[model samples]
Target: MKLFTCTHCGQLLYFENSQCEKCHYPLGFEPKQLQLFPLVAEADGRTYRLFGTTQPNAPTYTYCRNHADGVCNWLVPAESATQFCTACALNRTIPNLSEPEHRLRWWKLEIAKHRLVYSLLRMGLPVVSKFEDPEHGLQFDFLADASQDGGQKVMTGHDNGLITINIAEADDIEREMARKSMAEVYRTLLGHFRHEVGHYYWDQLIDNTPHLTEFRALFGDEQDDYGQALQRHYDQGAPNDWSQHFISSYASSHPWEDWAETWAHYLHILDTLQTAHAFGLSVNPAAAPAELGLQAAITEEPYEISDFNRIMQLWLPLTFTMNSLNRSMGQPDPYPFIIMPEVVDKMAFIHKVCQQAGSSAKAAC
Candidate 1:
């Protein structure tokens, strides 16, 4: 979510940009470096040399095979012998591209997926693809509804490590209708990706770990029957005080959902805070009293900040300003959920787990 620049022309580039507009330089994202660099084709024409590297034997790279479909801009070191980058390799199924509209929907899905993958990698979390570990590795399927083929409707949910998304959600009208029908304040393609992947990481990071005890205590016992819990949820709706305990009404449906919803919000906070930090954003209202503590300065990356209190401190004021700005522009608030005390407790647990995961990865190195 941080801003990026083209190495060749210093043009401010976006995460999804495949070329620098100013210099017309071909661009590819270097995940290891977390950079977008200009690419030059090598002598054999199958690999590219990255610009701005002085090493005499710098590794040549190639874009993920999905790049050919215009859905990926990430690079893979040519020597690694993998056709897809870490992110693209997780695909279990892609919407049939024979339909022109499906191609555009797939492109929209990839944008969200890449951003999700970038955050996971930035946090040093494991991102093994299903191909690498068939039993437990993560996979994704972008599928169409029953209307497309007289079959079952594709529900956007996660089972085991596979996340299935309804491709129609990429359409603005379809997604908006679903949001209203569900009585949700905020929903988007990125939110769906974040929420489902949260389920995947629960298996990878916390399922049998020591954190499970605290997780159960905070998020409720996930051991409860999921199907019945959801049935009850839909039958009677959320509790009147749901906002006091859960991030969203849907989160109140079951313990697992509560955890996933909180996890997704935790990610939203980290990525948004990181973007704020990248832009050197700070919030201070001259008219506010000092006792309100309504000031914050984002001095460090959110992932590196171990103090959850510090993150929440900055995030609250940032969201307030952001919402106010949106109101001024006659647009809905970009962030519509509130982070109450109980939600904060769950988010802190997530922050601790992610920090521990990052530390464990470093120690193994």
Candidate 2:
């Protein structure tokens, strides 16, 4: 995510901000421009025009219908027939809003989902909603478990193209307990979205392509029985040398999981690196020796960078700086995993997959 500014007041703004605090200007994101524009209401009171523009035919826009529920702030062209923005359109089921607590949880989940969508759009990846392509499009369901509603437990996983997330995970206490129980170093709503969506993309981008051969060589064959693989993983646990190739213990459960885990880490790296680049952040401590190789800088967007090595070069130093800041505040490391040589090879494959997808989209255009 990149830093944004209010066009009306030049005040620094965040990705999710709906109004500029300094100027009280209404704001809406322009997806085509990738900008958070200060909005001016149109004469009919149904559309908005950009703050600095005065053209009679300036593009008009309106907030997605989800905005009325306070769960989404994304905008759509006024001329668009769809009521939801690209991101909100992916939602197959939302928590029942009649329950007061469910509203807040839905809002939290939307924040994370929007961020995930933003990154996907930035990478020029396919993001068709289930409504657009019912058979293969991506979709989401925010569901409640048996504890909340005498229903079957909702597991956070992807099947075909639909991803189901238990609304309980949105509760901070519940999420923290699960994190500790699994002995995981890091976990969050955004991480869950990223990881599960990775499964969806694997089906779309690599399943029947030539890339599958390379994917299997690096991540292993995904044809193995998933349920049995997970059973063995929980019963015996990952081997001591798991980190030599896998990104997480859970990743070792199956080849599909390893790909999903690596894919999520790839998104984490690209998004964080882009944020650092937008802010012109550099990690160069004078006291740190050159041989330590902890000094680095980012001058380009990670999504556009074809070289995976360059992305890692900036990522390592950026993580070092981020972890140090977390420690200063007596918090756990923001990024708790190390990228080994074997893992980098897998990440490179993912990088190529994304680059190829982007190129194919452009060529079709």
Determine the backbone clash count of candidate 1.
0
Q: How accurate locally, in lDDT, is each candidate?
A: 0.91, 0.91
In model 1, which range of ten residues has the least summed lDDT?
A: 145-154
lDDT of 1: 0.91
All candidates: CA RMSD (Å): 1.3, 1.2
Taking all chains together, each candidate's TM-score versus the true structure is: 0.97, 0.97
| Model 1 regions lying over 4 Å from their true place | 148-150
Candidate 2 structure lDDT: 0.91
Candidate 2 Cα errors over 4 Å, as ranges: 148-151
The digit string of per-residue lDDT tens for model 1 on 289-322 reads 8678778898888888999998999998899889
